[model samples]
Target: MNSKFRALTFILFMAFLRPALSQSVENAWVRRPLPGMKLTGAYMVIKNDTNKDISLLEIQGPDAEYYEIHTHENIDGVMKMRQLKKLKIPAMDKVMLKPKSFHIMLIQIKKGRLTKQAKKTELTLIFDNKVKLTTETKLSKGPL
Candidate 1:
């Protein structure tokens, strides 16, 4: 009976602690689509509160036909957009995805996906550890 009680206690403890172990998204927003533009950008701040590093695998949303993790690199004095396979967030640290740095590229945006008025969009962030986080973003004029 003592062992069963201990197991139950452990389970309850983990259940309450699971959320703290996951990555948290903050300041998530997407750029307003320009006239006849098929591509736009999304920015956010991701915080990993867990003890272990987290790998960002992919991002998906219905606002765009596809999405990719991208970073700007200076190659030969020219800025280039490089597609990142996985972005790592160090334990107890935050990674900022912003313009001219690490950001999410929304390619082939669906027509009328965005408007002058801010609208909330759903974004699914997939991690290498099989953790999926669904975050909402408000369409904005720019990263700001």
Candidate 2:
């Protein structure tokens, strides 16, 4: 193909791919489970830059048997955790997944999947409207 034709093709391809990258996951971090423990927690920032709301339908971690979204609430001066069916991120906004707020629970994790040392763990973030994104979480013994 001619040089001009190739340049045009590249521009068209990039334009087709722009919308897919508008959403992003940032500051992804997962707590390393203690020895003999079967669970851990994960946190991240989910950004929705589109004009419509996005709902986080599910999360899948290879190191864990399952995952669930959770949130903590103050009830009568006591903190309680409840599992959330789904987490929503409004358009042009971001959802911060952290301790004492919206977070992910990695349940029944396989032994030795993560250690005390720092490691990179992959998790699949499933969203509504047929969106799925995978992000790597740095694993460590975090205080939160």
| Model 1 segments more than 4 A misplaced | 1-19, 75-77
The pairs that clash in candidate 2 are none
Candidate 2 local lDDT, 34-84, one digit each (tens)? 789998899999999988999999998788888999998888989999999
Clashes of each: 0, 0
Task: List clashing residue pairs in candidate 1.
Answer: none
- Model 2's alpha-carbon lDDT is 0.88
**Model 2 regions more than 4 Å off:** 1-21
- Candidate 1 lDDT at 104 equals 95
- Model 1 poorest ten-residue lDDT run: 111-120
Highest-lDDT candidate: 1
Error of 1 at 51 (Å): 0.7
